[model samples]
Target: MFDGPSSRREFMKAAVAVGGASALSACMSRAEEPIPKGTDDPSSLPERQHAWNDVLVHDDAGNVEGPRHQLLLYVNLDHDGPPTEDDRRVLESALTTLDRAYERSHEGLVYSIAYSPAYFDRFDESLPDDLDLPEPRSLAPFEDPEFDRQDALLHLGSTRADALLEAEEALTGDRDTANTVTMESPLTDVLAVDSRRTGFVGAGMPAERQDVAGIPDSKPVPEQSPLFMGFKAGFAQNQATEDYVTLQDGPFAGGTTKHVANIRQRLDDWYVEQDFEDRVAEMFSPRHAAEGLVDGVGDNLGDSSGLTPDIIESIEEQAKQYGRVGHAQKAARANRDEEGNVRVLRRHFESTDDDVASLHFPSLQTGISVFEEVREAMNGTDLTSNPAIRQRVNNGILEYIFVRRRGNFLVPPRRLRSFPTPTGE
Candidate 1:
């Protein structure tokens, strides 16, 4: 039901944000391709719930393309204290219903459930000694973000708009069936949904939704830009491997720590004041702009952001000289381990939730400390001492992005995914 030139593109984006039976019906009517069906066997899925790279669609340059639409369900348990046996069964059946209803891919559906530190406090036992899942906190001297202390977070994603919406409706008891598979149980029966956050990515999406508040009315978003910031991020070479982020030993082995940050964007200055060259300098590095490294939305950089050791190490000097530093260049400082492997797997997406521009940044790592360290690096607080680099000015995209909320969670292994205990047994 869209009427004009950009109807199909805008309809798909809006349908995901406005999820329910009506949105699904509107989307289904316009669906040009049929969504793939899921498997009957839960055993066919991977042990790591965050695992999505293999099934993700890859670009011509070999970069993994994230799902076009995503939904985050913030839920709270119905009862206090530890969960009961029947509660576990109800949650498991609801999850397994999703497995049977859709394939675990971008075309079908990919999902993961994570528990907050507040949820673990309900138990007498503590988390395993190996896991470092501290409660969310303000990382920077300037930021004062509200902490998200919900019991659980359910992340659902797919390229098909109808599939993601249908999965949500099915899980929340809005529908009895999903993809023609009768759902055995609904997650809402065991957990109450506190909030629903939605987002989208992939080329042409940002351009289609630029009429929102954060972006300028000039409509400068490029058609190929996957992010609202006008560049591609989470390149394979720049990201931590799934194995690197997985907890290797402990009761929670194969599990990982997740840190989600909701950042609000006010980008009128980003597009109006700064030209393309200035943006490239702030997003990548002044050297990148000087050398002409990033061509148009950074698609030319291939599978990585192309931040070398020299480029990352020179942020200070660049700040002193050019009066600005790049966001990627500063973050890369703490992004690597002693062995040079990347630290955190960042799966960030753009959102227009509440009619405001924002980003849902979900990062997975072996421990929450690793993510905290990387975020501290991204904050670039040390460089603030320099007269040229203030907190929000000339400090790499910080001038436009504001941290609104933050939360930390422990994503258990698939075996313990359903109402897992602190001990993971």
Candidate 2:
């Protein structure tokens, strides 16, 4: 997020010292005591752990505020089998990986960390997925109505850093971009452009980022999110879904979902769609197992009842929701059931050639941290419930962390992709 490469590395290294090796050893040292021979079982765990990453926020100047987004993650509590010790190892690996990534980051240019609890947290554990899969909506690819692309200022600016430089230029009237370079404290380009103040994520922010009425706290839906807390995600399933409502083409428009999808729905000018969803593969049609998180979700423990019982029940519920179901593209909305199970129902919607774009996260931390929490909270005896089969506790964490970090990485590659696009056209 900061500007200078070297400074970023140093700052990240310090952050790593706090979140990774140091924290991990503290946990492992206490539990060095071995599990009882007869009580070993893998069927009682919640989920697996996978690779970890980081999320660091920076300003246009040379200040960085970080929770290192990738360091934290969410997990599926409900599974066919119990969570395993291997799952815990992966979780540890992820934390270590994130720290390493940060330690390797550049520390010069714009850098500084906003000190705030809402923006960052380091914890022992959290709740896992129950019978329901989290509601899915657009994750990122935020767009500007004026520029008509995923990012606002960058689409309209001369350089990739234009957005971040907005603040410095405005305050000092300094047109010289090179004059502001700093090696120790780098700044984030995201803070410069619009500088609208990211609510809770911002320094001295007064209110929480606005959310939809019912989205749960787990998914870190930003105030800019189109969905609400408790009801944050949308579900659409096959068998239980009603027929897709045919849409009529009337006068309609598309823009940021945060504005139109709620209060102005009755009007013809309002409708929200996922940003560039058509370009990416979401909700696989002939969904083959793209990634294998579920390779071991179900393992026998010689009995149905065991650790992570809630997660097992949740997966069962999810299967039932999509049971013998079908889908139609004409009209559909993704959502979850009363039990937190995901469900998608076709609905009438206004259509336009232009797709509606919205940012999905900076979702709630609760969802991301759920798995490790259970890993820590569960009885020490239960940790080895299913020693036979290894659980990938970090799988969910990997998914969310990767998604979050991808948004950052995409900043550069996406720009690179755009450079040649016009020439080819």
Rate residue 375 of model 2 by lDDT: 22
**Lowest summed lDDT over 10 consecutive residues: which window, candidate 1?**
1-10
Deviation in angstroms for 108 in model 1?
A: 0.1
Please give, for residues 96-178, the per-residue lDDT of candidate 2 as tens digits. Answer: 22222222222211111111111111222321222111222222232112211112111111111222222223222233222
lDDT score for residue 390 of model 2 = 17
- What lDDT does the true structure give each of the candidates? 0.91, 0.20
- Give model 2's clash tally: 115
**Lowest-lDDT window of 10 residues in candidate 2?**
251-260
